[model samples]
Target: MIIANISIPLLGMVDTAVMGHLDSAQYLGAVAVGSIIFSFLFWGFGFLRMATTGLVAQAFGRNDTTLSHTILLQSLVLAIIIASAILILKQPLSQLAFLLIDSSEIVSQQARIYFDIRIWSTPAILINYVFLGWLIGKQASKAALVLVLVVTISNMIMDLVFVNVFGMTIDGVALASLIAEYLGLITGLYLLKRHGVTIKLFKRLSSKQVSLFNWHWLQLHANIFIRTLCLMFSFAFFTTQGAKQGDIILAANAVLLNFITLMAFVLDGFANATEVLSGKAVGAKNRSQLKQSLLLTGLWSFVVASLFSLSYLFFGQQLISLMTSITDVQTTANNYLPWLMLMPVVAVWTYLFDGLFIGTTRSIEMRNTMLLSTLCCFLPAWYFLQPLGNHGLWLALLLFLAARGVSQCFYLPRILRMY
Candidate 1:
């Protein structure tokens, strides 16, 4: 699970590393801008994955194959609709996205090229999300790991060929990602068949079943959609503000953000394990197991977080240099390296808590806490501390993360009572 989750960010890191060594910082910044736009766009639909995981894990736990199959179909249906809407609105979405972002003209132009090219992969990307969530929920970690590994490695190879051999630069990375998504979708679909789980989308569900599924599923996912939107917005805001500081700072922050992503996805392995175990416990109505799962996963996540913190503190500069050859960008990234060092330990709790809440399908609480953390905690801090420059941005993000966990803590007492 950890291996699979880590690959998600590593894909972006590869993209960054490829562009980072380019002649100009603008290429890296362009990739950074383009990546975050997709992050905001795609991660907003992460409810497709999270909601599917929660629902399917519970069904799998209860040994209810029908429900499990139905959940996948429902999620994919939602994914297709959302993907089509994104395609339809691609023009205005791009305009509004670039409008909110602050970027140099060259960077903005390059980012648009990347966006225009990659937008075509929308449906494939969303389908991959649903497939990954299904595999994780079914506890098919090995298969999930294989899926991610194939796509990421494929992406890296394509990136090299396109960037180095063909001189495509930013567009090369975007094209690599576009091609990889379709490949991943094909691989994922094959994996589903190999696992011998068949999905029949239009099977005759009772009227009551359809109503219940629609009502509860939509409610759960709507909350998650809003939660994901706010979460992505905070990061997007961070990127936009970083861009305002100039291309070097933007590029440096972009590199540093990858480090944060590294820590998040690494810890998320155990965090996701919690989802499977805890969701199963919820299905079985085993309170003790749920509590135990949370404790074990939380403890293990922190252990990994400790290792990551040390890694960042000790080798951050070397890692920064590996990402970009630009001396100014490397030095700028190093200046803020300490923040990355603190990110793992500081951010671990929110991530751990997220897994717990998500597993038990507490979407409303998840939404509320995230809303408070972002709107109440992060944005205001950034506004007041803007004069301090990037430090303010980093601090606001840290506080935002911390606030998410702390706010969620208050709800835990009530949640535990439910069990």
Candidate 2:
């Protein structure tokens, strides 16, 4: 899972590196803004992945193959429905996203180009999410790893070919992603068939079973959707604020955000493990297994996070330079390296707790805690620290992460007691 998760960020780094080397910072800024818009749009429906993993993991724990298959089918149906709606509303959605982001005229124009091409990948990306969640829930890590590798490797290759060989720009990056997502979806379907999850399984599901719009499922997805929205909003807000500072700051911030994302995907490997193990424990009603899984994953998460901080402390500037050649952007990113160094350790807890909550299917707590962190902690800190510039924004983000972990601590006992 760790190997698989790390590949996810490598694609983003490649995109940033490709754009960052360009003569204009607007190119990098465009990718950053465009990526965030998709993050808001697609990740808002992240509940499809989280809910599928939690529910399917529980079914696996109970040794209920029928229920597991049902969950997978339902999730796929939901993904297609949501993706269709997104495609239908793409124009209005694009306009609304650009309206909310205060980027420069040049950056906005390029970002729209990126958005226009990438928006068409909605169905492929959403279905890929369901495939990933289902594979992870079944504890099929090797298959899941293969699916991710296919997407990342193909995307990276296409990114280089389109950008370097064909001399494309942000549009190249967007096209690469669109192609790779469909490739991933195709790979996922093949893997599912190999695991005996076939079209025949869908035929076995009755019309009543196929309909998953009940209160229980809807409530679960709703809470997770809210939680995901809050998470994406925080990142989007960070990008928007940086854009307001000018193109240099926007590009530099984009470079630094790759560090945060790299750290997150690395740590989230442990979180993913925690989700499967903890969800299984809950399904089996095994308190000791749950506690043991949490203890081990949490310990490893902190250790890995510390390694990230140390690496950043020593090699941060070199990383900034490698991502971009622009002197102004490199210097600006270097100035903010300390904040990147601090992020891993501070944010690790949030990832850990999120995994635990998702594994146990505790979406309401996830939603409430994120709301408190974003609304009460992040926004207020940013509002008061406007005088401190970008440093203040980073600080506010750290506070938000800290608030999520701390607030979630209060809910841990209840989870344990329930089991």
Q: What is the C-alpha lDDT of each candidate?
A: 0.90, 0.94
Task: Summarize candidate 1's per-residue lDDT along 323-372 as a digit string, tens digits.
Answer: 99999999999999998998888889888888888889999999999999
Cα lDDT for residue 60, candidate 2: 91
- In candidate 1, stretches whose alpha carbon ends up further than 4 angstroms from where it belongs are 199-213
Q: Judging by TM-score against the true structure, name the best candidate.
A: 2
Query: Model 2 segments beyond 4 Å from truth?
Result: 207-210
Worst 10 residues of 2 by lDDT: 205-214
> Each candidate's TM vs. the true structure?
0.97, 0.99
Instruction: Using lDDT, give the best candidate's number.
Output: 2
Q: Residues 1-419, candidate 2: write the lDDT tens digits.
A: 99999999999999999999989999999999999999998989988888999988899999999888888888888999999999999999999999999999999999999999999999999999999999999999999999999999999999999999999999999999999999999999999999999887788786445665678888999999999999999999999999999999999999999989999999989989999999999999999999999999999999999999999999999999999999999999999999999899999998998899999999999999999999999999999999999999999998999999899999999998888
Model 2 scores a TM of 0.99
Alpha-carbon RMSD of each model: 1.6, 0.9
Superposition error at 116 for model 2 (Å): 0.5
